[model samples]
Target: MSKEYLDGIIRRSLEIRNKYHELERLHHGSEWTVEEDALAYLTDAGLVGRNIMSQQQRWPKAGSQTELEHKLGENIWWLIVLAKRSGIDIKDAVNNFLTETEAILK
Candidate 1:
């Protein structure tokens, strides 16, 4: 897919996840907790980590590209949800840590 199309999907995903967070805040679900959303995010994180290692041929496990891509996409979607929940811009948060690392290590 083209970068433009990908950006549209990213923005759309964020919009949907943000709405989910709002619903969560209102306790719209039967349960009073947003544990489901949190779980989905964590699961995606683990899968994506595995996918990265697999891509690098360091996983020492079995998996196909199609599955890996899905995991990676899911991970990205969840990361955006996490950022939204924390009131953080994903790009800004990464840049801040990268910028501070030099001083911290020096």
Candidate 2:
């Protein structure tokens, strides 16, 4: 996907996470729903389901596909938060790793 789209997904990831935190505060972490639980731990069924269906002829249900994409962004958001918290710069890391990997391959 395009960087712009990726940025938007990343934005959404943080947004949902912030909402979850708010819910926890409002309910003392006792009033969340099952769906919320899905987002809480990044239990992205869509991604997993896709893998299951990949080898099959038919596609996964549309709704399941949507959930997968949503979860993908949310998971990435979590990664962004963790990296920021740990002062890990993924961009630089990716560049350094790419060079090392390429050298090894060559």
| Cα lDDT for residue 44, candidate 2 | 49
lDDT of candidate 2 over 61-93, digit per residue (tens): 556555656666555666665544457765565
Model 1 spans > 4 angstroms off: 1-10, 18-35, 50-63, 102-106
Q: Tens digits of per-residue lDDT for model 1 on 14-77?
A: 7887676677767754432345767887887787788778778988767646778988777778
| Prediction 2 global C-alpha lDDT | 0.61
lDDT of 1: 0.73
Separately for all candidates shown, the number of backbone clashes (residues 3 or more apart, or on different chains) is: 0, 0
How big is the positional error of residue 15 in model 1, measured in Å on the Cα after superposition?
Answer: 2.5
Best by lDDT: 1
lDDT of model 1, residue 78:
76
